[model samples]
Target: MKLPSPVQWIEAQRKRGHELCLMLDTFDHKPVLQTLLKDRTHDRYSSLYSQTPIAELAGIGPFLIMLDSGDTQPLTELLNSPERHWGWLVSIAAQDFPALVQHWRERILVGQRPDQGIYRFHDNRVLGRALSSMPPEARPAYLGPAHSVCYAQGEHWLSADNRAPGQHPLPEQPHWLQVPVPPEQRARIRETNAHRFLLAHHQVAYLQLAEHRDPFDWLRLQRGRAEGWGWHAPRQLEFLLVSSLSTPEFEIPMQWHPRVYEEPSEHFERVCQEAKLLQGKGIA
Candidate 1:
């Protein structure tokens, strides 16, 4: 089935009372987010904080947590430190933080590869297949191995450093002709493709506004775009404004045209301007 256009999706969401806005380089808005987290007057939503590792939280919920990995400090220290730059603004109904931790714990156990360490979901063989299946124009946008199936699987399979008692060496582990994509991963691949197309073609980004409680559902909706267009999310909206770092030359007037700005402030100003224009035109 053909999916709804990004604008159509945004309009459907707006009707439900959600406000969407786009900002460039979410890192620039760290102070604004910190303020939002401190003020709880907004009855519509509540902020959630967690000390858990982000990797474990991945695929757990619809919430996107942007961290400044540029800081070399430990994550725990970074989370509680007064200097903590970004804050998480989550919906009140979407407070599934504890459940997300539990889900990740379970997933860790299930994804363990006998002698190998944890299986990296992104490196799954199914993802490779999905990438290969995309049209040539869209395929190059996704970085990583897409040609050889074995290479992709090898990337995900983390061999144990030392074998446990009674366990065979990593090289001796049973080899399979094909590794089927888990049902959850399949759904992620599909949704990821949809989001990727939106970013690459429509030049829009989708952020997780509310908490998707189900791990499977949450995994499916993530933008999943690793590179290009400088993809990042602050909080509050599932899909944010579509903007690009480098403006593209387009023959037709795009509903949301990409433009380059000297600074993030300029980019954000342009985003707001464009949003207002679109609203005035009744586009969404």
Candidate 2:
């Protein structure tokens, strides 16, 4: 099935009297946006980080910017084009920016009380998967105010529409509730993270590994091996996975493995060097 491109989708939304906006994850192009928005101060944009406890980091945080459907070229051109931006499109029936900002602020922190953590729902990669995994009843809180949310996955654009219609109320304080992430969702998130890591740090190895086995299955298998080795920390598991990518059967020398009290940085470097040496000689 053919999926509509971003511009096509935006045009359709505009015709429906829906307000077009973007929830940008600016981690990669903070400077580019900073410069672009300076000349276009009339365009409404709210940094999710501003006025929050972490206000100092506002410059690098995600932004909720209203998109001028007729004129998106300026913002899109800053980083070469719209295709390079990392965010999802939001279509809202009501154009209340303050309400929209509060809606997202409430979602910034997730998980149960006392153990709450930052939720990167702004990232299109994470948003698409997270929304799919959520139950029908649980979606309203996340989809508040927005009539529909759309994101791109590979060459296809995927979206979720607000089925309930009415706006979900925002709390007086930014709410931090436990958003249920099922076991399969957890595995999917882990798989995505691992694949992103491999692509960034071990592109050739990731390509070779993908040709043999699916990245998710390989990650699950590698994760099991890491757990079997009693390595539970994220850093330790990542080190094991990266090593396995270059040298499929590589194992951390028992003596070189970090102890419970030690950090994995030193051990990661040692194991990675050993893996590289073995890969060079075809001995791993």
Best TM-score among the predictions, by candidate number? 2
| Candidate 2 per-residue C-alpha lDDT over 1-284 given as tens digits, one digit per residue, 9 for 90 to 100 | 12465666667777888887778877677764565466456447889978875455566678987766444565455323435537788887755666788788766754454334456777776676667666766667767877777777656776677776445865443222344556775655566556655666677888887887787777888777666555655566776776566455443456555556654455556666876787789866
Query: What local lDDT does model 1 show for residue 243?
Result: 31
Model 1 lDDT tens row, 71-101? 2232233223312222221111123333322
What's the lDDT for all of these models?
A: 0.30, 0.66
Q: Please give the lDDT score at residue 239 for candidate 1.
A: 28
Candidate 2: list runs displaced more than 4 Å: 41-43, 74-85, 112-114, 135-137, 169-284
> What's the TM-score of every candidate structure?
0.23, 0.57
Clashing pairs in 1: 204-242, 207-238, 209-238
**On a 0 to 100 scale, what is the lDDT of residue 197 in model 2?**
59
Which runs in model 1 stand beyond 4 Å of their true positions?
A: 1-261
